[model samples]
Target: MAGSRTRRSSRTRTTSLTDHLKLPDGYGRPPEQAGPQGLDLARRLRALTGVDEDLLAWVWYERSKYTALGGVVLGTSVIAAFSMWNFVNEAIGEASVLALLPAVVWLLFVLNLDRWLIAPQPNAKRRPGPLLMRLAVALLLGTVIAEPLVLRIFQTAVEERIQEDRHGDVDRLRGNLLRCNPDPSQPDHGTPAGCGSYLLSFGATPGGQSTELDALRKDAAALQKRVDQDSHALEALDTEVREECRQLIRNASSGLLQRTSECLRLRDKAAEYRSTHHTAENERRLVRMNDRIGQDGSRLTRSRGTFLTARNAEITQRVAQERAKQKGIGVLERMQALEALTADHTALFVGVWMVRLLFVLIDVLPVLVKFMSHENSYDRLLSARSNSAVKVHSAAVHAMERESMADLEIKQEVTDQYVRRRKAESVAAHREHVAAMNIRERQTVDSLEEELRRPSTV
Candidate 1:
């Protein structure tokens, strides 16, 4: 009996296990039970993610789901790392502890981004928005990541171009300075020295026309001195004439008016010395000297103006050159050079993009190929098997319901029969009791009658 009980208990446990393995009424059977192909596919999918068959079937259609998702995540990580590296490289020149924050954030974003790319939704129609957004973000990120690396890889050429740009800037500044100076002989002309001293001295020293200006100034001074001497001689002669006229008038007396007139004429004649020293000739010489001085002064002024303008221009050019030198080539400048280089070399740009696209395709290919392929035979078989399971479960439920209804009817009929029999028995028992009581009462009446008859005879 002990052995039998143990065997029965083992059997009950096996039955319970089998019952547990079976699907619920509405739920489908395992894909493996559906067919060999579905079973094979289920095993493959199970091997891929190490998830149970039921859960896998509910989520993914095939093994490619795993491959595609993994590929997307892996590719996103590669691109994101490079992208973050590039950003950190350009922003701070070298990586730092602070840079790691953005790197970590970027990595998390990339991981989540993959999920965002392939996140499941109930409606297939609304999926394109998310898919396109992911693609756009991936493309943008890939471009940003690829551009800096590509440019860095070609650093030699880029640096060379930058050096060329610097030289060009220097040459431009030099040309501007030369144009401003227009005179090479000046100490400050078209040179840093010239520019430095321009404001202090007004370019007055060692200029091209310095000697000529000095000579012209000296000539002007000499002419001025000669004019002054001529004026003094003329004044002395006028004084002598006035004094002689007064003396004549005093000597002639009031009656001799004609003598006074003669004396005035004599004084005028004495003043009129007729040599090269004559007042009229001296005046002419002074006028000639003044005209020459004016011409010399005008020429000197024009020459000075020219030199000063050139000096100012040289100063401006020098200042600009210094500023440009101080601001050297930077990241933006290098980037601009790369852009121009790419424009000039279309093949290079194309090659770089092709490499980037290759990486992107590596990431997205699994998803694209899986989705684009026709429905798998396993999937179709599973669907059919699920439908059949549902139908069978529904039929079994209906049959159980019918059996339950039949059992209920039989139970109800049995209960009614039992109730009726009990009521008949109860009624028969009550009738018998009444009959017994009537007999007893009759007997009692008979006895009483007999006693009364006997009593009357006595």
Candidate 2:
């Protein structure tokens, strides 16, 4: 009676547990009341969760739950793909046909990843280690997935900020280059006293031509100085001679100027000065000096022009290089601009974070749902069904192992019996062989005794 009661209670418990898994009578029959076609799509989706569809189909809630999780994976992947599209587009500087490749690849990868994260496992509660590892992975992926979407949410402002920043950099770089490489056409005050930041070792510095030109100009000026002084001294001597020659005593009546000794002396001195200057020779010397000065002047002009031109050219090239360095927009720049936007405005900060967390939540929804949900009817049914199959398979394996063991034991008995029979046969053969040897020895001894008796006769 006790054994009967135990068996009865076990059946009762099983019936109660599996009652929900059972369909209504005739509900699963074909032609009249067929299976739920609505769950066909759900079954396909649930396949991503790596479940037994035949088993899962019986549990409607499990099918719905897993199907929803698969949708989340697909939705998260779409978001990820969109974010990737923006990244690729921004990096390439325009919409690119190639952007679709990376987006599609990333979408598939994220889809697989989220599916793996949400996939069901046996005894998940008992294994905290694997659960925690999956959680960590999901969180890391969430963060990665959230950022690009967050930036995309504020795309307009972020893009504007990025452009503004790039232009600002161009201006700043141009200024630095200009400061470092002073143009030669502009008056070079040399480098400003503390222009350390902008100054470069190589720049549009005026060359030795300026210094050489200055020296040439000074030489030209020196040449004219001696000629001017000689002209001045000769003019003074001529003036003295005229004044002495013109001095006249008032003659008694309409008297002409009389010859004066002082006048004669002045004339002689003027003649000596004229001889030293030598009108024709002095003109020749002045002409040669003027020509040399003109030549020097022309060279000075060319030197200045060349210096300005070279310096200007170098400044243009360097400024252009600097400007190029500051010109382009990129993924990193957009990210940084987003950060700046958030920092500058409280509204933006709150809004941006809200969007970020929303995307992260979306990305990790499947993981969170699987991790945090309490076990429902679906869980119990799946566990019971799977566990039952496992136990049945395990029982079959044990039965095979026992059958193998029995076969091995029977083989062992046969081998032992065969060995015992062989041992008995060998013992009998040894006894017979020993008897035969003893008889032969006795015969030898008798023959030797007879030989001795015969020898005595001889």
Candidate 3:
């Protein structure tokens, strides 16, 4: 029994010895050798790089499954914000609404846009590497598309508002001018439209001064009155003369005494001719004189007809020329009138736009305040959130510990036996003192030498 107990005690001691020799599950048999300060150094490097769990989480989130949803939410938010601005602006004025578009767009780009849309993959091959690069490219493209839209909306809204005010002002001015009758002597029909806004506003008061337009207007009125009077007198004189000529011809042809005298003279002439020794010669002479008179009368009648035809043709030609000249003049006058009106319209538009621009500037104040407050609130909320650093450290430490245990296992199994052999081989290589480039380095050197040979200078 004493032998058995002693044997059992020996067995227990043996087991305890084996247990002590065996490594813990995680610690490999030989244990890993790394710098004691490795974790501390890693932490310092991370701190220096300003890389942390929150940043990594954000990056992962951006690149992860939620990316598209985030984009949609951002886009929806932008649209909703703009809608709300419009609603509020309706209560105020349109000019303010006009200014809000670009301002909101600016804010979207300046703030939450990148956070919402851009993926932050910092460990990519290139600087600013993959995710952010894609976001930047997307942003540029978006700007190309959206900036113009914002500008157009702002411009159209502003223009419409300005035009409304200008139209109202024009109507008011026109009405006021119509009510205030100018002096009769004033040109432009004493109307505001004709006088134009500038001239009306700045012209001397009617009581104090007379302008060239006024004098010219008076002269034109007097000339028109005289022309009317002369035209009427000429019409009456023409009628009276036609009546007198008809009456004289009628009275002369009807007088009985005149017809009797003419018959007596013709008979006396016939008897005288019969009593003469050369009555045939006298008759022939009388016939010749009568033929001469007939010829003269026929020539006079033809001449009168020719004169009438020429006069009619001249009148027609003159009328046609006058009409063509008048038409050309009318066309030029109308073009001038249109140009003047266009200038007036342009001036009015410019003035109205200036006022609208001022109003827009004022309207932007509220939107600016809202944007500022939103930004501040968002920052405060983010600050209130818990830090993720502890979680990050735990994961990193777990990973490192696993890697260390694996490395120690590999070393114990294989590397430890080979390390001395590797060291001896390295010593032997060093003793040989051969300085030779590797195949890749040799090729690089050859290329560089070739380049140097060809080049005059670097």
Number of the top-ranking candidate, with TM-score as the measure: 2
Q: Report the C-alpha lDDT of model 2 over 1-458, residue by residue, as the tens digit.
A: 44455446555665665575566554423443254556466556777766765555465445567777777777888988988887788787778889999999999898888777877765456368877898888878888878877776788998888778767876776566566656433445466665676654533334444555456556657655766777788789888888877877655576765757888888888778768767547667668766765776576667657655665566567667766765556778888998898899999999988888888788777888888887666566667777886875676566556666777787899999999999999999999999999999999999999987785543
TM-score of each: 0.43, 0.67, 0.19
lDDT of candidate 2 at residue 63, scale 0 to 100? 53
lDDT of 2: 0.72
lDDT of 2 at 448: 93
For residue 190, give model 2's deviation from the true position in Å.
Answer: 5.9
> In candidate 1, residue 69 scores what lDDT?
49
What do the candidate models score in CA lDDT, each in turn? Answer: 0.60, 0.72, 0.43
lDDT (C-alpha) at residue 158 in model 2: 87
TM-score for model 3?
Answer: 0.19
Give residue 290's error in model 2 in angstroms.
5.2
lDDT of 2 at 428: 94
In the range 225-285, model 3's lDDT, one tens digit per residue, is 5545554554555554444434322246665333344444555544554455344454455
What value of lDDT does candidate 1 attain over all alpha carbons?
0.60
